[model samples]
Target: MTAQVQSAYAALRPADVVLSPDDLGGARATRHSFSRSLVRRAVAGGWDITLGRADLDEHGCGVVVFDVSAEGHRWSFVAFSQTIDESDREDRVVASSWDVTAALVDGAVDDDDVARLRPEVIRQEQGRADERTLIWTRANRSGRFFEYVVDRLADGAQPEPGVFGLSPYLLRSTAFYSNGKFGLADFERFEHGHPFAVPYRAHMLSAWLLRELGYELAERCAAARSETAVRLDGDWRRYFGLGNATGLGMVPYVVNHPEVLDAWIRLRELPLADVVARTVDRTGPDVPRVRTLLERAARYLAEQGDTEPTPYTSGAKLAAGLRPIQDLLTEYATYGTMGGAIEAQPWQHLHEAAAAAGSEVRGVVASVLTELADDLDDVVEASLTCQERRDIDPKMRCGELRGLIDADYDWLREFDFTDPTQTERFWYSSANNEEPRRAYAGVDPGERVQHAVDVARAVHALSLDLAGAEAATSVGEFLLGHPWHRGAVARVQSVRDLEYAELHANLLAGDFLPLHVQRLQLAVYGMDNYNPQSTDWLRVTLFSGAPRVADLVDGTADDDWSFTPQPSEADERTYA
Candidate 1:
């Protein structure tokens, strides 16, 4: 477990792994470490239920506070849940209020602190949080599901299991505010020795705790309505998770943070490549464990519901790719035996077979790599700290810059930026709230403040600017002449050395699938059960298959939930 041993093991692994690091799923797993870090904190008793009761009535309106103190860190999560009129309930960022408004404060909170934070958190983007708050967020219930569950519980019976299974979560957080937005704590505050310093620890922790609080609220309402009402089936409760609605807002994060993005993907890829180098012990007792992991993954993919497509990919396509790969893996575990051909470079061979099968299959293979090599999580987490800074080297010659572009961004050649459809869409921030918004280019009024997420266009324009410059002209001189190309040039130079650093898409393309970008990031945040609302946004569940807070408290929590499908009622009972 030492750093040196881990490094040696990684180096001994084959360069090629279960899937390419660039493979969408493998790349996504890197971001998924949010769960790992959260679980680590949970296991270590880093969080506390300072206050469990919600002071809400039958209409489900009230306040609840959760405080956590560990590793010399202290913060309180305060949520104000209220009843909203149907007319005021909207999912878009433009909406100002929600059924629940929450904030993570920098210190333990009391009745007076909750009173002070209530109005601001409720106002959402319109309100302000001082540095004392780390994150501000809001969620609305799945109105119909909420009513049904509440009504069923009020009647002292469990809602049909199918109702919970179809849409397993009660509330969907529409927005998360952090990183100094609204004068809250900037992420840098968590740097180095900070307790929740792992990337996205604050936001992920807030969201996870919010889900647990939602469950508490629901159960409290049930108990209030009917004295005999029992808690939601423990299995059903664990099956439920927090939901998030993501939009074009997330696309810029991937583009803006090349180094951070690269860190996530690279850390994940290292484990995969390391796992690929391992010899498959087909004859050893470890075979059953490996087979069980593969089977669970296969079952999850088989049941993954369909979603409408973006230009890039769809759930149906993912399912199509997964079934055959699952069968292949199942066959390997079933019929293939000791001294099988798979042992000859087990991971490499499986990866090749998956690639030969198809892109979706390759993605699943990458997703399963971390599970196959459980030790990789520790390695990946250790690597999360100590990110290398990526400063633009402006002193490079023009020819050298072009060569770098050619080596890394030749993918731009496939794009026709001049086409109307290619430049049809634009990403912009709303002046009303400064939240990210997408619009039709030229047709939309906010194009003036459009975000610079159009990397393909930026690169294309940079190439044109560079074409007229002398070959020996330094990049610094080129930037001095055309200042607009600086950001674009910096991206080209930085991403040239980072694998899976830049998203491969034309942001302005009429058919651009921002959902893929959203999925790519959210998947890293450990979201599954994707349910798209539109081309611009989708709702996904987090911690659906994860353990409850109580489970971890008593040391019964199992870390087997990542990418694993929720079991059916029959399966749960049978296994239990």
Candidate 2:
């Protein structure tokens, strides 16, 4: 699909399809009813799963080096599996030892690389960056399934895929490092495309590299147990996947990037709305394909067990709920869904069907849009661009400025994030390598040094200040008047056009937790294995492992190495 088709699809505004005023959840304040956040999160995570296979193709193992030929330097993540006292293991930001320790290897090295990386990767992760490495980090098996699967696999068996599910806490404990987050290379090497325009690709390189090292250890354990120099063959799913313990630090993205967030939601929602809006196949056989997609989504989600708020089952249940909407869509109501305004408008009918679905189905049907479009993933990836370039448009009239401020503050002020229901914790990156974490407002650790980058509150403040200021104030003038909120003002003033980006919360309020902000970000960018327990560490993947020499040799550039299929012709549609 071309970028033109993608953009044309995304440009469908709320006004184009909305029936009543049911835009933002309901009220004008809640008008952001179009939820791009959840759709984007699912798309990013799903994309990574597919990308993981590609990484596997690159490395011959279950991980692979991405498209990195422009810079031929081989950077591999050398992972080590050292059994530590389980009783002593912890998910705190300050814990020094983990079930695994990994380091990025620059080019092929002799004996010197192994000796240097072992102690250096371990201790420098204890906060020593002078190891002369590009990236260094470690992760505990966030799931007991790691040990369980190893036990099962060692007994000569393959564990079920369900063993690889993610938990919010484990999800919270995951982290990644760039440059020197834990004393590796400075981030500058990755800013341009050379070694890192591809962010997750680089970090996965490290994780996959480490996983290969685990194969060495597993081979050793197998040899000692069975009494031979046991060479291992076949891929092991039980021991794969990086473990991350996450917390509120990384769960807030669903609400923050409202516009970019909108892009993700819209892609999913628009397509879903389109599909449901279609005639229900009075004589067509395509209905089953749609139902099959829904079933696949439901089954995949069910495999995840559950998670709070938005449980894994929610996605499946969402699919089930839409079946009724499909039924409703079959026989047209006597009165048109939109009364008469958009009697023939398919998108408008979609809005009416969702509105009749109540809020729960409303949200669910809204989400089905993700599976409708051919280029949903592309729309999702496009949303990952940060609104760092957003500028405060100074051209708006003073009246508009005052109203936007008033409206923003009133909507955001409703949530008492400090209250148990509202503000349950605080978020911070621990000094122990800067991994993300969450603790009681006063207990966890660093409550004083909070990273309060919540855009909703910041934007609200900017609006209110602008509203109360002199009539002729430009956004720059307002920023100059209050320099502290400049970063936020820049974001708000510039990103007003992006409807799905803001989370409508005060990150500075006593209830604010930065981990939620971080998770929200990780989910949006699709960075898995980010441990929230390590507040200072942002666990990300790099080049994964090296791609298979066989595939590259066979001239099949389209190989999905993670789970490579039998060699085939060089089709031009490679999934990089």
Candidate 3:
């Protein structure tokens, strides 16, 4: 709202290109990512998270509780751990059992609360909870890594850091359910005047707790096996993160909540623009900081190597692309030192160079630039409570509606709805759990009950109808004559000012990759090491380099944990 903020918004990349699926898919986590911001807030608020209870046997089957106190507010994370057969450990929403189930409660958990939550948390969707519970979630142990860590610790040694080459997680969370799902507290209760008022703060915090719990479970199981077993090395402990497997369930959220999506993209883009603009005029402190961030990113990417090859670019390829950009930055630093005069926006030149390399490289550069913005926390926190309204202006003339579509929805023309492939897919909810699923239109029987995620098709249909209507006809009158176009009209009108609201691609298209949408949402949540298992679902790690429980309690947490590199061999020696 300030002049400076307005200038920053003005500098954002053109909406058409940034909002495209290709660009959004390449987005990486930055300091402003929800998970990173949540950790920063915890550190600033002097939050204390400590283990409250541990009642597990050598097999790590029992209940554990963690008490959390933040800014005089109390909460508890009650976890129920149980050993499960490998075949029973599934990440799908339809899965019946898991290695661990937990809930984040609104108040301090007591004996009665744990006893009451135990049965419900384990039962997942089949169970129920009261309004006091904020989140209900479950995780499965990361098969080989979990066992390797426990075995190494039990032998009074440390697992080699190379063991985490594939993933730096001990457990993979299947889902985190909240917002009145199965009777948990609705978002309205804590959306305001609560410590976790920021949209996904509670969810991210729960994920952090899950990561901590994974470490505890590993240590407990190891200690039970040997008298010499010791706690995991501090660095290794922080290196571990909570894993997550997300599928089609998130695609609809991306489609249905354009306002929320726009806010997230705008917040990230605006800060990046501001950083570039401010730094273009000078080689200030941020110049070196940007270089340092780039170095970290390159190293992290190199360490991660190539993930399972899918349609997306691999980390190794991204690392190779970054090499030239790194050299270019070093050259820029030399020019600044040699007292070179202003040419044509050196920062813009650098960005252009990155773009030429690849879309993923461009995103990496943009994410790094965001780290240099002064208003990151301010912008992110202010945008936390979305004020977007999808209400239609029924009084507006049909001509105006058509004009808005012509200007903003021009991208809709790119798709040919007549082509069977463009309309091949339809999204629907599963009857068993109401989980979102996409199916081939004719091949799948759910087309009759399909969800309305076909924004492109809707806009095309609406435009065709508008062509025949009188120019001065009001949208209300137009909708009254053709009620089928109501949702499309409202959607087109509501996003008139929200440039990044709608994805430019047709979700129903046969070649449309849902993983791109998933990656975008996960990047916003600060997830790392995106390993695509298939086109529709993927595995990601959250809070991988974030502070451990000890750091939060000791007030040593910082926000420089993004783009975490792999731990070196020397790090493992500390435990030995």
Candidate 4:
């Protein structure tokens, strides 16, 4: 961390900060005041289970079963490891082969079950899983790093630490499947009484187990080749993480689950309000702590390389903007206070300063809040819930429904639907495996099967239908005549109170960048390394700086990995 950068953060404190409404916008306006009660919740409960591990061979071409039993419920995470030809190492959603395939079965498994699943699990999308399975996923190794580490360890030496920084994780999951697709257990089955009841807990746990499998594979392969093979260095192990490839297919989720999406954004913003309210003095003792946190964040941001080939975000812009904020923070640290006293709301004051600096700097300031507080865990738990039932108030008049749209979707009304540019793109599924894909409106072959992700056009068409209906007519009465409008009307009624429900921009517009949508959702997941491979798909690194599985399982873990990039090679060797 730079000296000035450290000092500038140390200068921040919440005093009698006050600001006009216009002082806050973008990153600054997003800040909120928080208290212990606001961010706190009942500590999440613990899970205890009998442990089991499989003995995979040196080649890693064998089965590993992990049996877990907690609170009278038991299940197995079954992994099938195999070698893939270099030509088979592709990351697209449609890829049919993988280095490893895994499944979380609903109960304890025996040899008979493994025999039945061996052939099918490897097939991935074409495989058939019974209700016994919870999730089916696959990962491909980071080819260069996997081979490099294995050979070095087999040669009785540690691989160069620098290799871990270039690409951290051994394998990256391309897809995670659940919810009864291809005959697996449906989500509703695991909603109540199941051990993995907290939404997608099954998937999350399965992915973590697969991460463990990756570690085991590398170790086993090394031991197979050399009697003096050594385990990966503990520091290097901490840097290991899972990578994911996401694309346009994930964009529809926010539109389809407006209530859930709104809840997530709403919870995130409230914490900012809470922090702003609680900050006391501009030069308070807490200034040192804030400064240290900001320093870590600034260093992490400084370390990001131009990894994405076609990034939606510009590295030059972020780098250029960060320097001035660092300089300002340095000056503020030395001065002790920006003004004579801490304002009535210092967080808001800080926010305004960041906003004035630039949008990118504002985001940097906003991220610093995570280090300052611990209450976000409760917010994260609340985000997992959704109002599953969406019943329309059929009695509401057509006029009232239109009023809801007019009030909530005013930005949406700006789009000119008749313009070809506004409706130039279409979203569809592939003919082979039904994976979501994007295509031009007139040029694509699958426009006839385009998914209903065009929320803007749907709303426009509904408005036209309502225009011809009687104002006094009930929505149910109108829907009875024009059944096609029911899905759009149901979505609008379900999300009328959700401020961040639908995206304000047109998804089908000529200039629409689906990468923006993917980044928005992934941000909620706390992902980093937003490396875009192209305009269509991108890769991300998760749990990169997080504690290793051994640390976590042994109760010696330090849970402070948020936004911290793995230290550069020099720092790695210094720590070693």
Best by TM-score: 3
Error of 2 at 486 (Å): 5.2
CA lDDT for candidate 4: 0.65
Positional deviation of 386 in candidate 4, in angstroms?
1.2
- Write down the worst ten-residue block by lDDT for model 2: 26-35
TM-score of 1: 0.87
**Per-prediction TM-score, please?**
0.87, 0.61, 0.96, 0.83
Worst 10 residues of 1 by lDDT: 13-22
Best first by TM-score, ranked: 3, 1, 4, 2
> Which runs in model 1 stand beyond 4 Å of their true positions?
1-32, 45-53, 164-167, 304-323, 334-342, 385-394, 431-435, 563-567, 570-576
lDDT of 1 by residue, 1-576 (tens): 677446644564232221122345223333235865676666665454455446877767888887676566787889999877877777777786789999988878788888899989999878988878989989888766777767666666665644543247878778778888888887776656566677777888788888887787788887788777666674566777887767767778867877776666556567666766667655555456545655665666555445343333454456566665555545566656323443445556666677776655665675675566655555676666645454678889999988877877777886887789999988888877557877897777988778878888988899988988998999998888999988887777766756566666777888776666676677678777666667777777787767777765567667677555554555323111
RMSD of each: 4.1, 9.9, 2.1, 7.1
Candidate 1 vs candidate 4: the lDDT winner is: 1
Give the poorly placed runs of model 4, Cα more than 4 Å off: 1-51, 69-73, 156-167, 190-195, 281-286, 306-309, 313-320, 323-336, 339-341, 355-361, 464-470, 477-484, 567-576
lDDT by residue (1-576, candidate 2, tens digit) is: 566455445545442233111232221101111112222322333222111122221112222222212244444445544456766476555677766655565554445665656675665446555544666656654345444433443444434433443322111123456656765666555554343443344564454444444443443443334332324223332224334444444444443335555554453344544444454333344434334443433443343333322211243354465566654444333333333442454334554575676544454344333334444444434433453454556566556666655544446656543355444456576676455445566556687886564555455556656657777656556656688876765554555555444554555455443443444344333333233333323333211112322223334322111111111122212121
Native-structure RMSD, model 2: 9.9
lDDT of 2: 0.43
Please state the error at residue 22 of candidate 2 in Å: 15
